[model samples]
Target: MKKLLLFLLTCLLAIHLAFPQPPAIRYQVAEPRLADSLDISHYAKKRGLRAGAMVFGLNMGVWTFDRFILKGDYAYINMHTIKENIKHGFVWDNDAFETNMFMHPYHGNLYYNSARSNGYNYWQSGLFALGGSLMWEVFMENEHPSANDVIATPIGGMALGEVTYRVSDLILDDRKGGWSRFGLEFAAFVVSPMRGLTRIINGDAWKRRSTSGKQFGVPNVSVDISMGIRTLELKDEILDQGMGIATEIKVAYGDRFDTEETKPYDYFSINANLNFQASQPVLGQLNIIGRLSARNLVDKPKHYLSLGLYQHFDYYDSDTISVSSAKTPYKFCTPASFGGGFIYQYKGLKNWDINAFAHLNAILLGGSLSDYYKVDKRIYNLASGYSTKMGADFIFKKEVFAISARYDVYHMFTWKGYSGEIDWRKIEPKTLNAQGDRSRAILHAVGLRADIRLRNRLYLTGTFMNYTRNTKYRYFSDVFSNSSEGRLMLTYKF
Candidate 1:
């Protein structure tokens, strides 16, 4: 049954890529001006050819690495595996979720950069991404190609790629020279290596003008650096407590409520978070939300509905301390997800704004370590889930002060994996039982934030978050855990 659903999804995605919707009439008001200034027809064809060549070159490079460096049989090109994959069609893979869901999309974003840097629009760039992923799957490896990878790669790649492209633009200053130009270009490369390489190859790395042209709206970027203490408890017993330094950077592009023909990612948000601590100093996450389409409600100028896609990458590793035995069990999880959802926003009320969103996503692949009873067990699970978030903010004194609160809940169903046993020594010797049982889990998070304007483009911020997770298995004691964190930080925006 699951296989059938996966195959259907693959077919749908292929069709969507092969025959995209007609390009919307974007920037029509400026078309005449652009046409007079530049040769649009000739440039468009040249860009397309360059983008295709880049994609082909990238695929060949990956194939070389897999065949020569990895030397794994699965990485070799085998006609037998290719034939089998074609006959059997799409199937769920045995690889961990992180690799399929997270890493594949990361590679696909590089493919996306090839098209984006050559002047393709967002939708067209996504199609190129899809084409690149398909070529790699069909020709790059000996193992059977996966349906999940095809679905996750292009969609998730476009989401992550757009954000990378925008952030790289912020880091680059083509008008500078000497060390400043070199430094800026290097930093942009760090954010988006593929785009930077393309720039260098095209002799635009030190051009005196921006290549992408002006964006639709003013872009806002902010950074928050904070040091704080966090406390975690399980079953009413203190597990671990520590002080940590965390940093978050946010980029918001355009306004969602703008009354104009919206382009893909016309209104987007990207956030990156990093935490430094003893147990897991490299705890990292990248979240991206891009608007696909939106429309204003009839007779309500301030109310709008939007459809968007999101890509989330999370890596968490920590130590758990047992209160009684003092034994420490290590826990780690690397889960990545790609999904789409609907967003509703209201700004009709004076000095008040409300926003709500709901999304359903598939956990295409993931890996985790479970320690339900202090016995560390490695596990892998694939699941489906939904999440909802709602928030409201009050503005006062003309943007000088603001208070906001948000609540979020996520639920996931793990039907194929096992939950950790309370006592591993007492479990029966059945094969199914040894693998673990199915489970369901819910995560609840609530946060409140207040910002006081200290000066223009600067603010003092205080934020608090309470998070809880509850897991229930068909045959095990339900486990509940919670944590609280608070921070005071100074934020600067540009």
Candidate 2:
């Protein structure tokens, strides 16, 4: 229940960003005579109606699929079950997997589009996502509704939805014609299908408009493609090494200090990475952060403090030899967390930028597969932790070369007293020999990154990261592991 309240409060903050303000144009003007210059009130009613229709259509589609193709009893949702579930209150459900991590966010994306295409702001669109999630929980399924779904769907959805929306916006070209315009529009559609649907519905898909005079501020975007080698070493074990390929994309929205009206997610950064090792996918990570508040501390704003909310996702799955057996077993771990943090930035030194941040996060939920005593199996843990990071970036020779270094520490704790134990086989009462056993882990990482500009919009980049983890169990021996990776890549900036 506490978790539910925390999520609810966070969502409220999101909605606050969407509260109605005095009639003013919020979008940056790219051109003086653009169609968007028309009075917002002129189409307010029509947009509202369209939004409603979209909500209804989405619900209908989900219901039809659930009842017909899936042959589920969602159409006959049990009101009694829902009531009972509500009475029981919220919980950290362990049965959820792909639905919580992927599908719920996708649904939220659809809801966001329903609101955004109708001219709602980013934060306002999140409210629509929440409404849609509530509807599904209350009336769309026969089984009792899940608390996890309600939280993950809206928040995670909004994060991913906004990113998709922005990327689509970057791809769209309204001024072009012929195959070039069609390709651009098609690419945008691939990024945001709901937006495409709404455009077709409104006849905007077939219309051509001059966008040459538009002057919107463009965000900074970069993509990195690297080939790397990674090695993992367990205490006293031989190094396990493999060649890997990694791709990373980062986008930094316009500077926050440049404007007074700091809209939600106006100063945001997004990063996504995928890595494959030895012909198999091994790791993936996604990070999104949006500044919520900021204040200048120096005369020329050389020093500042900012607060932000962040979402983090990490997944690693690999095959390794089990300590207790000769068989190679699969090891996997996935952690997704959301929280807010504070950042301090200093630019007092010429050509240098220094940043430090501390974050407190709720694990929300996570899972792992661990092997004990030759038994290759899966185990799970729920933990909350905090992290601290500090980094410095140095620019040299008129920004022709840049060097950066960072260090981070993370700590997590989990206590299980039989009540939270899912599979007792791995964590037997006798093995623990006591109640209220606690487990803790800490990870330390250091990274170095460098970029060499080869041209105005292209660069050569290199990065190296070293990571170490230490775990302690109340009644078991401590486990220690470490890994290192190095990458060389080409980066393009836009």
Ten contiguous residues with the weakest lDDT in model 1: 16-25
lDDT score at residue 75, model 1, on the 0-100 scale: 72
Runs in model 2 deviating more than 4 A are 1-49, 52-56, 59-91, 95-99, 141-143, 210-217, 220-241, 256-261, 278-283, 299-379, 413-417, 420-441, 454-457, 470-481
Model 2: lDDT equals 0.54
Q: Write the per-residue lDDT of candidate 1 for residues 1-494, one digit (tens) a residue.
A: 54564344333222111000011001111121111122233224338888888888999988888779977666767778678667755544545434655677888888898898788878798899999988887767665566657866787788778878766765665557789888988998888888888889887677665233323222433333333323222222332333355555555555544536566765666555456645533534455656666655432667767665544443333443344424322222223455666656667888656555565554443333333422223243334565555555555536677666666565756565445444557643222322223666676666666666788756665555566667686766776766544444565554
Tell me the TM-score of each prediction against the true structure.
0.70, 0.71
Candidate 2 structure quality by residue, lDDT tens digits, 43-108: 233376677679768987988888888887546656675786576554433432344555677788
lDDT, candidate 2, at 181 = 73
TM-score for predicted model 1 compared with the true structure = 0.70
For TM-score, the strongest prediction is 2
